[model samples]
Target: MPVHRVRFASVRSQRDPSAPAPSVDAREAAEERLLEALAEAAGADEPVTALAAILEDADPAELPLTGAGRTRAQWEILATLGARSLAAARVLEPHLDALSILAQADVPAPSGLLGVYASESGGVTLTATRLTKHDDGSDTWRLDGTKPWCSLAADCTSAVVTARRQDDGRPQAFLVDLRHPGVDVGEPAWPALGLRAVTTGPVAFDAVPAVEVGGPEWYLQRPGFAWGGIGVAACWFGGAVHAARTLRAQLHRRQARADEGRGTGPDQIGQAAYGRVDRLLRAAAVVLGAAADAVDAGELDHACGMVEADRVRGTVAQVCTEVLQTVGEATGPGPLTQDAGHAQMVADLQVYLRQHHGDRDDARLGAALLEDEHTGAEAWW
Candidate 1:
């Protein structure tokens, strides 16, 4: 199989051995250019294309977004972020501006992908923690837990984990080395419906020693940490778009064929079915765009308000399935022989859309709402 790779534009090298450390002005200038490029790439009109550019052109040391301007690097970050959260934004903003610099510097790959879980008596929470206390007055945390469904697990060298300090009840975040004895990458077993390319697998950690980044308070104060849900939505949106486009074109071609054929009657039912699928896809796109904007605006509640992210997360699968069904019906169940791309796209999307499931549904949103009620927060609009 041809693995997807990150590609980037080349720039001149500026590194000189024995040269003094770069001044603040130089660093800022470099960072600014990278961020601008990233922003341009990760926009509404061209996210998939933007992702391709970011993966191909990032310089980690210069941008701190990708571990390198490599697909593996960007994949690791995307996996670690799990596709949602303000933390992802925090990680995204700085590097989006200066990706080219990192692409040129040959930055190292990020640590690993199983560092986002918090070991709790209740369950495995996707919250950041602080467990280790290191020297220099800096706290080093330990992450000792298992994480299921990590993306690009084969490429990460380390992970940013969620754990707690033995001395305090507070949660903490740790950046742990994956090569350590405790970190064990597992087989890719996410046989769900979608994103098979993402390597959604399990990771086991036997008490991995870790370095704290921002302390417990800082890490906990970050976003909802449900970045995967967002990625689910993104993938879903992509699939939906693909399905809609494919079906629309198929309909047009079919309509033209029917008009030119010796058929006794018109395919009214087929036309209606195609029309409905197209409408759903159009609506999904609008909803998806709004949700993405809300997320970028640091408005989790608002984003969730548009329709729980989980619902939006499942939209791609639902929409794609509907489209496939419609296409199948329109073509009279001839296995959709002519629209192979549409079929493959639907297949690929189905593999990725399984991220939305039982516990991951809007029901969780309701539960979260109930939990908020205890804190005097309104549970509903």
Candidate 2:
């Protein structure tokens, strides 16, 4: 099917209440179309360039507009695209293309750069080092540290990474190719929670032949950091939106039956939970939308500094947990048996939520909102 047609059809699918909400397959098809359009425009067959364009152009709001706020449109776009990562990674097979695309967009193709590390001890310890040429034109450098919890490392060809130069002690970023002789990818080690399909493994590189990105001095200045955060945030946001929609459907379906006096629908707890989940997603949508707008406006510095990425991550985290709890209670074992979609969504959300767990590094968000006390701390309105 043509990409445009698929997208249109998927949109139409939304109208039928009984129809399953868009699945990972639909998300992947849409992403494939996007990748094709981007590849054609960059005039480069390399997947990195194409991936970069899509990441750069994507409207984050599409994924999961959280609130009924001013940014509804933007969140919708982000949630839609965010839902496709697993599917995208699956279809883009060989991992190089997807990894390269991620690196180009600065999304941290964890394993490719050096290696991805799982937080669990059973996971392999993967590391990447940076080598740089100093001002004296001599090849001298420093070695930075390792990052844990790399998602999608099992198949990435290379990763865009951050490291410190050993010689002079400066931060640097590199695109580490997984095919390099020294690169090693560990077996998948993630304990299932969500997003089980995407390989969350460890990659280890030992004194590998490395290529330097730009000049060593320009390393810390890379925008890839923000992009990486945004990518993960988008992916999580997508999962959350799917969860909300799925739960909402089940709730309403039950409610419909209850209305016919069959019992089960909108109980007080379910009603309250549904309302809370809706509000959470709505707020997430607004915040993520603003972040995307800031990116387009070239306000990346501000966006990154504020709770830009966190808004997406945090909101999704809360909503996914709440929705799953609510829907699971309302449907009981019925959803578990009859609706694989709900179960899958719950699993995916569990895994995706883990993305925000370990090294999210929210220090900046804490500092940014220190002065805005009231609005920042409150949960409602």
How do the residues 1-381 of candidate 1 rate in per-residue lDDT, one tens digit apiece?
111111111122345768997775775566545544544444335343344446445444554332222322332233223222112222342233223222322323352122233334335433334454558676545566666654444444455555555556566656567688877888877554333334546667776666665555544443333333444354444444545455466567766776888443436786687679768766665555554444445555433432345555656456656766666666553434565545555555555555467456767655656666453333445
Off by over 4 Å in 1: 1-57, 60-137, 163-172, 179-182, 189-196, 213-221, 224-228, 258-266, 301-311, 314-321, 331-344, 358-360, 367-381
Q: What lDDT, from 0 to 1, does candidate 1 have?
A: 0.47
After superposition, which runs of candidate 2 have C-alpha atoms over 4 Å from their true positions?
1-32, 35-78, 81-148, 214-224, 255-272, 302-306, 357-364, 369-381
Q: Write the per-residue lDDT of candidate 2 for residues 1-381, one digit (tens) a residue.
A: 222110101111136788777566665456455544533432344434344445445543222222212122223333454443333322222232233234444443343222322142443332334356569654433223344555556444455545555646555545566576665666777677455655665555666554455556444444434433554555466655555666677778887898899986677877777787777766655555555555545545533433555655565466567666766765578766777655665677665566565335455456545644642432223
Q: Rate the local accuracy (lDDT) of all candidates.
A: 0.47, 0.49
Error of 1 at 329 (Å): 3.5
TM-scores of all predicted structures? 0.57, 0.60
Worst 10 residues of 2 by lDDT: 4-13
